[model samples]
Each structure stands twice: as C-alpha cells, then as structure tokens.
Target: METLRQYRENLQKIYGKNDYWMVPIFRSLFSMTFLFFLSRYLQMTGKLGNPMVILSLGLLSFFLPFSFVPCLSGIFLLYYFYTQSILLLGVGALFFVFIFIIQSSVRGKYAILIAAMPLCFFFRIPYFLPLLMGLTMGLSAVISLDLGILVYYFLRYIREYKDKFSTGGDLVEQLDAFSGNLAPFIKNKELFLVLLLFTLAALAIFVIRNFSFNYSFETALAIGLCLESTAFILYPAVGMKMNLTGELLSFLLSAVLSIVALFFWHDADYRGTEFVQFEDDAYYYHVKAVPKKKA
Candidate 1:
C-alpha cells in the first residue's frame, strides 16, 4: 500500500509538467507561417516548376494539422476503388498542394522528409522518396523547437557555471573549448551507419523481388515508421542534453530498421487474407503464420 501510494505520487509529478506539449504547438504554428510565405514566393516568381521548388513546397506543408488530408484521401480511394476513386484522387492531389504550403517553420532540412509518410501510404506510392519527404519535414520542425529549449537550458547552465569562466572572452572561448571536446563524438559515425542501413534496404528492395527488387508502398511505410519513431525518441534526448547528437544517430538507425521491416512484410505472403478489416464498426486484423514457416 505504501509503495502504491509512492508510485501514484511520482506519476502525479510527471503528469503535472505541462510545458513539454507547448513546443509542438508552437512548431506547428511557426512552420505553417513559413510555408505560406515560401509558397507565395515560388508561385509569384513562377519557380514552382524547378526541382528546388519541390523541396521548398515540401517544407511549406509538412507541419500543418491538415497535412494528412491527402494521405487519408488516397487510402480511401484505394479502399473504395469501385465508388470514390476519382473523387478521392482529386482530394489527395489537393492535400499534396497543402503539404507544399507550410514547409519552412521547422529548422532542419531532413524534417521535411518525415511529413510525407501519410501521403505515400494514402496514394500507394512506393520508394524512399516519400520517407525522405516526411523525415526532412518532421526533423526540421523538431530541431527548431528543440534548439530553442536547449538554448534556454544552456543559458541557465552558463549562469550557474559563471565562476568557471576567467575572463570576458569566456563565452566564445568556452564554447569553442566545449566543441573541441565534443568533436570526436560527432565524427559522422551515426550518419554513416544510417546511410549504410538505407543502402542495405535499397539493395533488399531490388534483390528481394523475383526478377527485380522493386520499391513498393509497404517499403515506404516501413521506413517511414522507423524514421518517425527515431525522431520521436531522439528529440527529447537532444532537448535534455542527455545525448546531444543521439537524435540524428537514432533516426538513422530507425530508418534502417524501417527498411528491414518493409522487406519482411514484402516477402510474407498474405494468402488472400486481409491485413486490416473493420468489423461491427471496429477495425481489426487477422494475423496468420507464414505458410513456409509452418511446421
């Protein structure tokens, strides 16, 4: 009884903290405004046809609440091919336009990639391109918000550590000293690992197919999940200064894992069984063993 009371008290303390949720709301608002301005520039200057415009458009629409519109619409179209395919497709296209509208509110280039997952899933689009889109967008927004929080904490740390600095030149000199110490840890190990995993995923997609390893919607979805989760878990770590570079590193690992998951799903034969189904107004799925793996 005493232990239970203590646990409940701990839970109350943790739940009482409300500031964590504020950054995401702020990020969404900021990113939305950034996208509006960017789109206006592109459309007015008539540079929307350029490849850079594609990236810019992606940045604009990545963080909005309505960003998932095209994704849901596309999924509906696929599911209701007999009735609403055309209408759903048009809606999906419009949603894509919105995604292009709010891209820049985030800070990192990679965050844009994270916002494109739902679109790929909705439209049955294949390949790592959409994964790239969602990750870039999500990462960008996450990094911006995180950096602001980090700066606040860093300022506090400086105040407490003021005695450690000997002279007026301490700010730059101390920061440089700190950077020099941290340089070894940021030597691209995480980046290389992530790229290697992605490369393996690409190879698997090509090698796993009978005649050719082809990219599929499953592949994109798998990778997107991995990447998003990576961003999710790593963001707080970065903000807390627990592992400054861990977010990027973990994201890379997550990306690779996602690719591998996609391959597994691809290789598995569904045997005409539906992976997801709605029954009595509730959605569910039937999990089946791999036929070849059955004893």
Candidate 2:
C-alpha cells in the first residue's frame, strides 16, 4: 500500500510539473480528433477533408488556452454545417447557442461535458461522459450529459436523413421533419435505458469515491465498468435488438478510455495531498494515506 501510494504521488508530481506543456498537447490531440471525425461525419471531401485544416487547428489549439479549443471546434462544425445545408446550420447554431447560454449561466463548468459530445460520437463512447462527470463533477453534470446525448443523436439523425432534406421545403415542413426525427430518440427505450445506466454508473462512482478509502477511483471505475457491461449484455436480451458484439466492443473501448481519463483526473485533483503536512501548536502531525484496495 505504501509503495502504491508513493507511485501515485510520484506520477502526480511528474504531471504537475509538466502540466503547462501536457495540457496543450492534450487539447491539440482532442481538437484534431474532433475535427477528423466531424469532417468524416459531414462528408466534407476535397479541401474540406484535407489534413491542412486539422493540422492548422491543432497547431492553433496548442497555442491557445484550453477554453478556446471548444469554441474553435464549434466554429469548424458550424462552417461544415453551413456548407451542407442552411437548415442544418440554423439548427446547429441554435443548439450551440443554447449550450452557450447554459455554460455561461453556470460559469462554464460544464464546458468539458459539451466538448465530450463530439468525441463520444466519434468513439461511440457516450457512456464515459456520465461516468467521468459523475466522478469528477456534481450531479448538475447530468444535465450536460443529457444535452450531449441529445446533440449526438440529433447530429446522427441529420446525417442519416440528410437526403430527405436535400431539397428545400417550407419552414413548417422542415420543422415537422425535424420533430419527426426526434421522436425515436425521445421514445426509444434503448436510449433511455442507456441514459439510466450512465446515470447510475456515475452515481455509483461518485458514491464510491467518497467512501473514505484508498484507490477509491479505481474501485469506482471497476464498479462503473461492471454496471455498463451488464447493461450492454442485457440490452439485447430485453428486446432492444442491438448488435451485442458491437455494443460490447464499444463498451470495452469506452472503459479503457475512461480509465485513462480517470488517471489524469486523479493525478490532477490529488497531486498535492501527499506532500500536505502542516501542524498547529496543539499537535505534531504525520499523514500517509493509502487508498483502499478492492476486496
């Protein structure tokens, strides 16, 4: 236990010392990934799909603050949407405006959740958002997670039905079509089940992390993975008709990604604790806390 604690502390120290550089690298990587997937999803061929835009944005993201990356990505997405369809552009703009209002009202705390939406779509790892948010953020993050899911499904629906909207129609017709596309998402039992599973997983992680034990993060992750895996397995059996293998594969990948994210989160949040030692006149203090190992 001492060795594990020391190792974790060392890892945290290393990260803390280099976070200035490391953060930009991560931001750039995330930006590039988001752009790549966005282009592919939007079918932006020719110059639009060229690597130049991605590389340029990645370089720009590296130089810009982390907060700017999401905004930059949003601009890129809007440009793509405009090129595709004015209706899509309008809807996308309104959606993002709503997100902006929410974030502004909340002091930008849920920005990461908003950013996670694109990555979730690209990686088929929407479940990780709730898990991560639940562990690191407050219950309010549930709202962001839901909004992210809504954006994802909406974008997907647009892609699938882009052909139907190729020819411009009356505003009422377009609105009706958009509303129709939303029905399945609202009514689909599978989607709601997935959302419930994520909420429970996040709540489970949050609860475990507060258990006054060592390795709480790991335990939380393990429990969350089990919960998610169980849901994936049982979803098809309950008449969802999903592809079990694909679902499992996505879940496994998401779990791995979530673990990596948690490592960084743990290190960032707990880095100074190991070296924290202070004493008042009342008592001399020494502390070396160990995380609880799984039973």
Candidate 3:
C-alpha cells in the first residue's frame, strides 16, 4: 500500500507538472484514431471512398472539440446518404436532427456516448461506454447512450438494406416502409438484450461507486465486468449469436483503459500533504498531515 501510494504521488507530481500540453496531445491522438477508423469503416462500406475526404475528416477531428466529433460524424453519414438516395438522405436528416436536438439539450454533455457507439462495432471494448458513463455521469447519460445505440443500428440498417429500398416509391410509401423496417429493428431481441445489459451494468456501477467502501472503483469495475460477461455468455445460450472471443478481448482492454483513466482522474483531484505548525506554551511544535490514497 505504501509503495502504491508513493507511486500515485509520483504520478501526481509528473502529471501536475506536465498536464497542460499532455492533455491536448492525448486528445488529438484520440481524435486521430477515431477518425482513422471511421474513415476506414466508411471506405469498407463503400459509402465515401475518397481518401482525401477521409484525410480531411481526420484533420478536422484533431482540431475540433471532442463534443463536435459526433456532429461531424452525423454530417458524414448524411453525405453518404445523399450519395445513395435523396429519400435515404431525408430519413438520415430526420434522424440527425433529432439526435442534434437531444445532444444540444442538457443531455449534450453525454454526447460522447453517441460518438463511442459506432466504435463498438469495430473495437468491441466500446461496450464499456455505458459502464464508464454510469460511474462518472448522471442518470441521464443512460438515455444518451440508448439514443446513440439506436442511431448506430439505424445507420447500419440503412447501409445493409440500401439495395432493397425502392427509390421510385412515393414519399409516404417510402417512409412507411422505412418505419416498418425500423420498428422491427428497434424491437429486435438482440438489441434489447444489449441495451438492458449495458443499462443495468451502468446503474450497478453507479450504485457501487457511491458506497462507502475501500476500492470502490475497483469493486464497481469488477461487478460491471461480471455482469457484462454473464450477459455475453447467457445471450449466446438464449440464441443470440455474438463473437464471444472478440467481446472478451474488448472487455479486457476496456477494463484496463478505464482503470488507468480512473487513476488519472483521482490523482488530478488529489490535494497533497497538508501540514500545520503551532506553538504552545513553553514548547514549539510542528505537525504534518498526509492524506491517504483511497484504494
């Protein structure tokens, strides 16, 4: 424990001394990574195949606030829809507008949930998003996460069924078909299972973190992972096909990343050794108080 405390103190000192530039660098790196993958996904889908556009988006993401990344992504989706069909673009616009409103509202703070949703498809670790948000954010973040999930699935549906859509149909007919298809997608048992599992995991983590206990963060993470793993196992038994190996690997990576992030957050907020000096009659005394690091 003493060694661990010393290590944390050392980390705190280093971070405190160099965090200003380090933060932006890290943020830019994350943005670049996200954009690189996003562009790759687009290319793979044959949606936006232009390498230059992908490069431009990657550059744009590096400079844009993290909050804007999702919006830019939504725009890119819209552009893709436009290339496919005007009717598809119209549907995309409606979805984007709705999401935009929700994001711009007080819940906007949780918009990262939306941005992280698509990444889940590629890098399964993103499934930890709800758990992380639940641990750190208010209950409303769950709603943001749900909407984000819906958006991801919706976009995926469009991509997969684009060929089946009738471009010559009347507007109302097209919308009806779209709505009919979306209703089933939204009610998909697999989708609901994932949503329920993540929501419960997040809530559980939130509850555990609030308990007055040592190693609360670690405990919460363990509990969350257990819940996630259980769901993954049971879902397969119940007839939901999933890549178990990929999900397990993702969970492991996400857990490590979350732990590191938690450490950084805790250290950043730490107030180092407090001391007091007092003089008494016939004696002069100095006292020091050192705060213990929470496990």
Candidate 4:
C-alpha cells in the first residue's frame, strides 16, 4: 500500500504540482465537446464526409483561431484600405507578407493554423462571430492535440534521453519496460466524481434536445462556455492520461448539452434565416422572430 502511494506521488510529481490537476480534465472536456457537436452539426446536413474524415476534422479545428488572428486582421485592414480614403493596400499587403513570413517560420510548430484558415467561411456565419467561434473551438482542439503530441514525445524521449537527463535505466529499456507498469492515477476518487458530473451533464443535454430543434447556435455557445470553464478546472490534474477518446467523448456530450440548451431553454431559430442586403449596402437577417442587423 505504501509503495503504491509512493508510486502515485512520484507520478504526480512528474506531472507537476497539485495546481496542475485541472489542466487535463478541463482540456479534455472542452476540446471533446467542441469537436463532437460541431462535427455532428456538419454531419446532419450531409455536408460532412465519412467518419474517418470527421474524426480527423478536429486536427483542422485547433488552428482556426491562430489563423483567424491573421485572417480577421487582414480582412479589417483590407476593408479599411478600400472603404476609407487611404493608400493602405500596399501597407496591408506588406503586413500580410510579414505575417506569412512569421507563419512560415513557425509552420513546423504551428501547422494547425494553416488548416483552419479555410474553415472560417465554411459556416457562412457573421464575420466577427465566425472568428470568435472558430477561435474558441480551435483553442480546445489545438490544446487537446498538443497534449497528445506532448505525451507521445515525452514517453519516447524518456526512453531515448533518459540517461542524459537522469541516472535511471537506459532510455530505450525504460520505455520498452513502461507499458508493463500500471498506469498512473491522478485522483482516483475525484475522477469518479467528475465522471458522474459528466453523466449528469449529458442527461441535462438530452432533455434539452428532445424538445428543441432550433438550438444549434445556443448549443454551440453553451458547449463552448462549459468546455472552456471545465478545462480551466481539470486539464492540469489529468494531463496526458486524458487521452483523445476521453476528449472526444467529453466534447460530444457537451455538444449535445449545448443543443439541448439552445432549443429547449433559449429562443432562436436554426433555419430560414436569410442574409438580406439592404439598399444602403447593409445586411440584416431575421431567424424566426429574432432580428439580427449588421452594424
């Protein structure tokens, strides 16, 4: 019993301080929720491809925010250049050129941004909202992928570089021997509590969706909020132990909850919202009875 306790303590020490516990949990929950629901939404209308394609979609989802940072900036600069009386096109183009330089330099480390760039306009959402939504969604996605990448490399590195870093066993031997070791537990009791909480959250989502069809927007927003908050609370503790499966499941559940929140609890129309351009080159839309006009 004491040996198990010490082993768990050593594992925790390797992960970090107690403060880090929430990192894995929250990250898994949020990333999963965003990817699952968003994919489901895309799937319903036949816009999505096969399951393998959809499963891989989260890989593209993570970098949308970083890409949006440049995309939106570029868009705004272009708008200002054209709409206002300014010879800013050359300046804006130059700025984007610089951005490309930075992007290329960091491309190996931040390749996800390149993938998310095109997805910004795919939803045909309001310009600002897409940027915001894409970012929130992308954040969870990126962090989740990063965690997986870090875990794989960390495990591999501990094997290859173990002697250089520590007086422990030969790196390769240790790594090859690790699979036989019992998986480390972050907080066994706490995990059960969290799982129960997630189950309850799932139930809440189901009840909401059953009665509501016009819920996509609210669902998206709610899941975004929940995942973000929970991630803030859990990712540190769970770390890489919170694998892709856990992340995927949490995200899917959150998406369902979000859908439920939107249709059953909130008032919004998911269909028949037309993007109408008015005489003064302004656009307005009304989904059901909700009025949305451009500034």
TM-score of each: 0.23, 0.75, 0.75, 0.23
**Cα lDDT of model 1 by residue, 68-140, tens digit:** 4233322322332213233333433544344444434543343333333322222223224424333223324
Q: Between candidates 2 and 3, name the one with more favorable lDDT.
A: 2
- Candidate 4's C-alpha runs over 4 A off are 1-182, 185-215, 227-292
lDDT of 1 at 188: 33
* Candidate 3 per-residue C-alpha lDDT over 7-80 given as tens digits, one digit per residue, 9 for 90 to 100: 77787788899987666566556555555666565453553555566656756665656677677777777877
Q: How much does candidate 3 score in TM-score? A: 0.75
Model 4, 262: alpha-carbon shift in Å?
Answer: 15
* lDDT (10s digit) by residue, model 2, range 32-76: 887788778868787669999798888898887655766887798
Q: Against the unseen true structure, what C-alpha lDDT does each candidate score?
A: 0.38, 0.72, 0.70, 0.38
Instruction: Estimate candidate 4's alpha-carbon lDDT, on a 0 to 1 scale.
Output: 0.38
Which digits, one per residue and each the tens of the lDDT, describe model 4 over residues 86-135? 32344336545654555554333343333222222132211122223222
Residue 276 in candidate 2 has what lDDT? 45
Which of the two, 1 or 2, has more lDDT?
Answer: 2
TM-score of 2: 0.75
Query: Between 3 and 4, whose lDDT is larger?
Result: 3
Clashing pairs in 3: none
Count the clashes in each prediction: 32, 3, 0, 24
